[model samples]
Target: MEEKKFQPYIPADKVVPEFTVFSVILGALLAVLFGGANAYLGLRVGMTVSASIPAAVISMGVIRFIFKRDSILENNMVQTIGSAGESLAAGAIFTMPALFMWAAEGLCDVPSMVEIGLIALCGGVLGIMMMIPLRSALIVKEHGTLGYPEGKACAEVLMAGEEGGAKASTVFWGLGIAAIYKFVADGLKLFPSEVDYTIDAYKGSGFGVDVLPALAGVGYICGPRISSYMFAGSTIAWFVLMPMIALFGSDLVIYPATMSVAELWADGGTWNLWSKFIRYIGAGALAAGGIISLIKSLPMIVRTFVAAFKDYGKGSAGVLRTEQDISMKVVLVVCLAIAVFMWLFPSIPVSFIGALIVLIFGFFFATVSSRMVGLIGSSNNPVSGMAIATLLIATIILKATGSTGASGMVGAIAIGSVICIIAAIAGDTSQDLKTGFLLGATPKKQQYGELIGVCVSAVAIGAILYLLNAAWGFGSEELGAPQAMMMKMVIEGVMGGEMPWALVFTGVFIAVAIEILGLPVLPVAIGIYLPIHLNAGIMLGGLVRLFVEKRKYASEKEKNDSIQSGILYTSGMIAGEGVVGILLAVFAVLNINTDISGIISLGNIGGLAFFAVLLASIIFFCNKGKKAAKN
Candidate 1:
């Protein structure tokens, strides 16, 4: 067997294109829409928009319709710029929402609007700046090491569009289907939006699954490996954990009594015990898994840091040739000034200290995350590792200051989270820029587009947050502050003399154990964070992939061809599902119940039919391609 050779990196100047008015306008609009949507959803559900594919699709559509003369590279540049908002928003959303939860719970005092805004701005800027140093090592030295499917797809689309080929229709069709399905399922209770079912053998077996037609489609897209990991985690939670809880643990109340399925279980008592034990074990497992993964990736992290430092010392003067020296310097200075402004935004005595901490930690984590993304790709960023780092560091800082009260502790955490988010986004954006560079997009134009996108997205996201808060207050009963709750508990316990040192150490020990077992930690951590149903859906997709792969093909080319088609079809499904789920949620929020169950039943049956058709299509395409190759 031959080892796969990596792709070579193209220079920024050679890959990027000149800036244009149309790119700017389109980029700005996309940034706002994508950023706003991501932020809104992240705040509501703790997840952000998958920007790469959507941005590519929108860019292709706009360019084809409005700027027929524009090259695919130009469109890609615009989309790359626009996607920064979503990339940044994803990071911020993950961390920032905790502030609201903490504040509501009297865990900490809330920062003023100015402080909040400044923190957000600083985080965004810092994330972008931090990625500059790692560009060479991650993007250049490790070219093609990270299979950025979305980025690659965007590049392919641009190449096709530039050649005047109409290959974007597939993307558009996928997006349209996704958006409609998401709207109905998420926005309106069109059908029984959530499906609850349970097994009784385990202590606690009852579990609820969202029959998100679109998200299921997304799982298919993510393919078997990722989907399977997710599903395995879910299975542990629902089938193993839930039932165990009902069997052994005490009776517990959960949302929507009508949705609960305790009665269906043969031994609800056994299920209860299992559920309780699993919850504790899951928490431990999550922390353990994160630490284990981080430890495993430590060598790579160190190498990346060393390389980044060396690159930064070399200076941007002679290295970056994509733009004028003066312009690059000006941008750098402006970014620095913004950072200083962020440090001085609040008059609070400790604000400067907070800012300093954010800057230092932001730099370190940004480098780590960027390199990790370059190594393992964004899907496996070890968010748990970052979160744990934040928790421990923040806890120590708060304890030292004796600011363990709700006000001080929450404020500190909010500050830390914002910084972490900024770091994560910066690294991601940097990687995206590398993709643009590879495809011959202009750096300056992409940068400008990104800024515009940020502004638009920030405004849109702010509005969404305001609307959500006003419409439905944040609480356990509502969009439950699970992540926030976890944060607060850590802070209060660690700093307020209720430290779970034993549990923490236990988690660490488990992490080491798992590492020794040679298992990937991310799946375990994710299993710990998300509910069983989500994981199950992911696993189902993986199973489908496994089955598809199991079928024998005549040749290596034929097998590879079949695999690629399966992946594409599955990717379309996931994208479709997520888009539709969001739309459905929106409808539900508007108090529109369209009796979607009847439609959903049809959809369910249709989904099976759709899967069959997709399978057949892949087989046909593979066979046709194989025959064509032979001729």
Candidate 2:
């Protein structure tokens, strides 16, 4: 047997046009578009897919073909900068929405635009700065061992474009289709974006599916296993837990619920029961899953920390262009500056002690996140789980110091938000670095591109977030903001004495048992946490993927093309819906007449019919992708 040796597609000494003005502008624009799209999707569905591949495709189309730029390095740089927006958006949406939720509840004033932007800016810079030091150890030393699947796939897309062999139109096709679909469904209100059914006999038992293109794309991209795990969790929550509560606890009044279980059922339906009670259980599971994942990664985390410091103070002056990164000294200075900002910013709500937690956990999670994404793709990286753990610890520290109430909760979320962004961006940086390494691009240049994306994205994300909230509020039916809700619960549980510990502990043990069964717990826990309809929509997409994979193909290339086409199309769907969703939010804030519900009134039955049509369209597109790949 022969051992396969590692080789980069491009030689290390080779240089090509990379850091161009066109690349930076295009990438920055993409970052805003994708970031805005993802902010909408994550706020609605609690999951955000990677933008690297889609950005690569779009870069190829506009930068290579349209502008006649023949540089693969330029295309790579475009994706590197563009994808940072999605990564930063992911981190921000996961935790920052809690502020809006709190404001709605009258606990605190809504976080100002400046406050939001600064928090995102600080976190984005820290992530890029932290990942620069670990580049050699993770992206270089661990090369073939850690596949960095998304990065490699992105590189392949760039290379294909350079050779004039890449198919970029599928992405645009899906994007256009989905944008129109979203406008019809959400903007004109032709059919409800979500369709639900309630069982009259089984009081609290209800089922629903969000008929949105972005979620369907998410499911197909995530595939059967992960989607099923999530759906299973949703099933357990809706089918078993909610029903049991309705059966036995009918006479009892839940703490969070203002009335008896029966009365709550009549007033708010199944969603109220899950939000007030079952959501805490999901939070417990989420927290436990995060801790378990952290403990499991302890050895790796320790080794990473040791390796990082061993290279500390090492200058990049004499390194090869491809291996060059920002110096350790600059990283240290910037990190210290961020720490001072966190402590000094009154809007941040962090004291010296809180600042210390951000420093310690921020770097720690950054390392873990970057490496973990290398092993498993970013989609499965569990950034939210890590954020949960951070919030738990930070809230505890603040509570122990007597910083309790709304202020304390806000501070804890602020700290967690920065850490979340750090972890998310670090993972994204690692992936981009991997892509650069394979393509023989300058690491330092790419790092700068990432920073550029972050700055541009941070400015835009605050406005996007405020727009979405102003349009439909975070916790409303339109934008559930599930992950932020979990963070809010965790902080409240720690600071306030009104937490539902029984349900939470039940969720914790359930997660433990699931892990004992040798399953990935985070997805399942999230599935349980999210509404059944959302999970069901994702499950439909996963099933489409399963159907595609199960079929026989003429050759491996053909099979791969089919899968690639499905991914490209789905990515477009996510982006398309996101763009339109943001636009609809704008129209909403302007108080435009969007209620076409009466004119096109489908009601629930029509919604269910339209949802089936939506599912069928996904299957059709996937199969069409397979055929296109075969051709």
Candidate 3:
């Protein structure tokens, strides 16, 4: 294996024009699409698409085609900017919907859309600005510490374009296939659409599954280790935990009419006790995972802070060489001005107060997030940190002011979400900049490109949210997903004077134990938080990879050939499935059922078929690739 040298900074001389253009356009489009989808889905199912690698691929393809003369360094600069939109969108989607739900329920008077827009815009910009100071520390000083696979792939694509290799063709073909699959699944409903499953084992268990080839593909791409852990978590929920619930509880009443054991345990009483129990467990896992990850990364956090201070003292001039290198003082002034604008905008209710709160929290989280990126890399940044921080701060403020009613609660949640989004963006932006620096792309170009992505993303995302709200109301019954439920619980529990301390503690303990056991906390927490069906799908993908690797190949060439084929096939499956999944969710929200219920209702039979198809696809690709290599 060849060792790659690390470069801390990419001087201005190395940047090219096409990289800048492609990155900006791609970033903006992805941000809008992914961000909008996330908001829509989160409100519907409490989950969102992972846009990082997809966005990178799009940027790489567009840049290579348009700027054939550009160097890899130039294309990378574009991707750095382009990738920011998705990060910003993710942040926004994660937190903002709570406000919308709250307002709809009469918890708080709705802030004018203009006010919301401004908060989003400011948060995006603030995230970018805050990341500037930590660029060197995270990207330069600690290069290669984080295994940024997406970043590496993007860089490699740019290099391949320069070298005129077939890789670009493979990526383009992959993208087209993914897009078409999504269209058919989403637009035509070619496959049976099912979101979850129920097993009548022992007593009965209800579980949800996103069963899209895309999600399974994502798991495959994420590789076996992470996938295995997710599967383990799912197994515990379905095989162990649910079965135990079915067997022991005294209140279990079997539902005979449905042919499956639907355990009606306990009085149909206050709170859906069973659902709440599971949620409580998930919440514990989430908190524990986040806190443990944060604690473990504390040293890197300290180092990032120390480096930031030193850089700030030297001024922004030496830190950033891009054309947009405005001094920290200027950046601060611009930020303050934006804050004032956000505050004074008459369309925004409590604009000034809200802007002030957002600014303070944004700055705080930006520092924390940048440090987190330095420590864990962008792919594994503790999003739960932002969520937890927002919840705590907002709860405290609302309680202290005695405005813990629906109105106060919504206002607080909106504020917290805005801050969280900003922080998340800042952390992700810092990571992207690191990639750019190593490839010698100009910082200034990347910054501008990010702004473009933000504009496109914001408008697209806002529209998506509007459509979802207009079509389907934000209640749990209507959405059938846990996002609204989670938000409702957070607001009602803390503001309504009933905190689930026991669950929180359980989650905390679990996170700690897992970390101590030398397991990565994110996958475990996600597995615990997510439904059993989804985890099972992920496990299936991992198993396929495990089998492929286990097979004896004639030589290293054969092994490498097999691995490459697996990557391509798995990538296609994920892309195809994700695109389709999004469309299905959209249709469900629209209440336009394509009625593939028969196919979907195959249950275990359906799962088995999917497993078979995926396995066959991998094997077929491996054989094809081996032949191609021999030729």
State each model's C-alpha RMSD to the native: 5.7, 4.8, 5.9
* Residue-pair clashes per candidate: 92, 2, 11
Q: What's the TM-score of each model vs. the native?
A: 0.76, 0.80, 0.76
Ranked by lDDT, the better of candidates 2 and 3 is 2
lDDT agreement with native, every candidate: 0.54, 0.80, 0.57
> What C-alpha lDDT does candidate 2 achieve relative to the native structure?
0.80
Error of 2 at 196 (Å): 1.5
lDDT by residue (1-631, candidate 3, tens digit) is 1112444334554434544444455555566666665566655555555454455555555655654434565456545554555566566556666666667776566555555566567677777776665565455555545433334334444444455545444444444555564554445545533444455444435565544555455455556777787666656555565566456643543221111212343233111323455445565666556556556655766676575555556765644344233345656777798778766766443345566777766766676666554443354454544565456556766677665566566656666656766776776676566556545666555665666656665555555555656666556456543544455566667776666665556656766777888887656766665566666666666677677778887777887777666666555454444445555655665667765545544454554565466556666666666666776
Per-residue error for 229 in candidate 3, Å, reads 2.8
Among these predictions, the greatest TM-score belongs to: 2
Please give the distance, in angstroms, between residue 105's alpha carbon in candidate 3 and its true position after superposition. 4.2
TM-score, cand. 3:
0.76
* lDDT head-to-head 1 vs 3, winner: 3
Which 10 residues in a row give candidate 3 its minimum summed lDDT? 254-263
Candidate 2, residues 380-449, lDDT tens digits: the string is 5668877876887788898889888888998899999999999999999998988888788888899999
Of 1 and 2, the candidate ranking higher by lDDT = 2
Full candidate order by TM-score, most accurate first: 2, 1, 3
Off by over 4 Å in 2: 1-13, 29-66, 82-116, 130-166, 304-333, 344-348, 363-389, 405-410, 423-443, 457-493, 553-558, 589-595, 602-631
